[model samples]
Target: MSMNTFPIIRVVTKLLIPYILLFALYVQFHGDYGPGGGFQAGVILAAALTLYGLVFGLEAAKRVAPPKLMQRLMALGVLIYAGTGVATMLMGGNFLDYNHLTHDVWPQVLPSGQHLGIFLVELGVGVTVTAVMTMIFYTFAGRQHIT
Candidate 1:
């Protein structure tokens, strides 16, 4: 069965994307004080990107974010979060311990750097999740048969 690509879908997709991104950012940053961290943000971002893929088609989505690049980016995001923990451990502290970030800077610098690190990790998670979701949608959305 074929389905119509309606104008409403385009309208909704365009209007909702920015809000989705904003909400994801809020969830990512506010997680330290409460809940809803990288995972939730990633999901939201992925959902938004998937909608874009659905409305726009696989080629457009791939143009926006290629599949191979998405795979590497997702792995990089995981590695970054893991790397920070490993670096802390190598410094003889517990995993994710901020104090290991720097020596000369002391208490303030370490916390600041840690906060920045967390933000970068969150951003990476968001980007990778979005790209991967788009790629998955593209793969599953069906292909035309060649004559």
Candidate 2:
């Protein structure tokens, strides 16, 4: 029942996964300018990886993105999100405030740090979501039957 047994599926999946990943990145970065955002991007990224797992098998997917790595990424995303808030606070602004981010360093930039803050927060959210979804898929797929 190996995926490689079917050459067509294997080749098609291999060709498609890269495009999926590229689109995910596009969604992630372009979210600020358009309709897409962190949540959507995260789901897209997760879906790509999930597709990879489905086509390649659970073990292969795990080898590529280990559970431990995903767990760490989840924590890291939270830290990035929270740290942005903390940074704003340290800059003498309210929690989650973006204006303070640029006032002290680059006051000349129009729109200030708001956009930057939003981007960072969104990135954090995307990372967290991608990791969680992949982890969940791995857990459910890896379960063994208890007879």
lDDT scores in order: 0.70, 0.89
Residue 78 lDDT in candidate 2: 93
- Candidate 1: tens digits of C-alpha lDDT, residues 72-137: 877777777777778778877798785566645566544565665576566656656655665566
In terms of lDDT, the poorest run of 10 residues in model 1 is: 1-10
Candidate 2 clash total?
Answer: 0
Q: Candidate 1 clashing pairs?
A: none
- Displacement of residue 93 (Cα, Å) in model 1 is 2.1
lDDT of 2 by residue, 16-69 (tens): 999999999999999988888889999999998898888889988989899999
Q: Which consecutive 10 residues in model 2 have the weakest lDDT in total?
A: 103-112
How well does candidate 2 match the true structure in TM-score terms? 0.91
Any idea what lDDT model 2 has? 0.89
Could you tell me the lDDT of residue 85 within candidate 2? Answer: 99
